[model samples]
Target: MLVRIRGAWFVAVGVVVAVVATALLLVTRAGADTDRCTRFRDAADDRAGLVTGVGADLLVIGDSYSVGLGVGAAESWPTRLPGRVRVGGFSGSGFSRGASPCGDVSYAARAARDLPESEIVVVEGGLNDFDQPAAAVEDGFERLLARLDDRRVLVVGPAPAPERAAAVPAVDALLADLAREHGVGYLSMAEADLPYLDDGLHLTVEGHRQFGDLVAGALSTARQPGR
Candidate 1:
């Protein structure tokens, strides 16, 4: 009887230890994410301010595509864009979902905090929110648009990628619908035949140039007087 009781006690202790360890790991991860987000946010904020100081005509808030993750910043599409454009992009950010492996820096949050004033604010990105609920993504986008009420806003949907081909269409459609509902300009890259790297996600350097050209044309048309 005593031996059985001892074994039971051991099992209970093991379970408790496992539970405590798991909890500690989760807390540690959360803390690390918080730290990373703080550092990233500070740096991004400073950069945005500098861009604004240059009298930026356009401000773009997006994810790695905006940052040009694989390619260098100078080669990024945002840089290739016309005029003095400021890009506030964080890797792994989405409209609803926060930056993965980082802290809570979503599109709505960035629009509300990180970005500065500009003549045109382009809200780009939805790829990261692929698996997220549609309602959540919509809610986040609504919040972002609310904050940008005073600015000329443009909603740019995620580009078509072989990897996320299925989800990309849904996201594009949703963003397009939302932009129309909000009476803002919307750009859908769903059928874009852009080149991608091996990852089949981000655009290649050439692809970025093509994308930049496309956007420049759109902006030019929008700039024309009257409807």
Candidate 2:
């Protein structure tokens, strides 16, 4: 059983053996401004896994979708970023965990207490929060963005999955509004040029690769002068 906790893998294994994802993280907060990285790495042992360390000023956080659960290690958009980036996040995480069975900590809490410094931070998570009241998630999301202060943040809404087709738009709208309010970038994954898998919860490797390019383009345009 997959516990609704950060760094805990939740993929329902159906075969005798399966590959374990290496893009996992465990962070602990100390004081009001210290987020120590407990663990974050790719499963290099896996045939398709890739090893990449974090040190760059780019941080990406979100749930299993953003963690690239269904794709190869290097095929993940985060791992495939054009430049070096400090990637650290967990699957099953979201904006805020109310009665949801997906996460125990809100993305806002994680951002406020357990994130490293970065000029650009891409946050993508809201599927778990979609069932909850929008206002509640908005509250946490606002605080999350506020904590970043001067940092540039890009809100990547939940990917367009068959399961979330009907409900993701609302969350995406909410994020778009927040992006405007905070003068940040909001990339609507719903409109992203990608394809989904059979489960409809994850994206294909080609999809991720293409999405990575789109994300890179959006980030560049969003960072432009008077864009």
Best by TM-score: 1
Off by over 4 Å in 1: 31-56, 97-104, 221-227
Q: Which candidate gets the maximum lDDT versus the true structure?
A: 1
Worst 10 residues of 2 by lDDT: 32-41
Model 1 clash count equals 0
Q: What residue runs in model 2 are displaced by over 4 Å at the alpha carbon?
A: 1-56, 99-103, 221-227
TM-score of 1: 0.80
Q: What is the lDDT of residue 218 in candidate 2?
A: 73
Q: Provide the lDDT at 21 for model 2.
A: 31
Candidate 1, residues 1-227, lDDT tens digits: the string is 99999999999999999999999999998898788777656655544543422444888888877777676566667776666788888877888854255655788786777556677877778888888888989888888877787777767788988899999988899988878777788888889899999999988999888887777666632221111
* Global Cα lDDT for candidate 2: 0.63
Question: Could you tell me the lDDT of residue 64 within candidate 2?
Answer: 60
lDDT of 2 at 19: 32
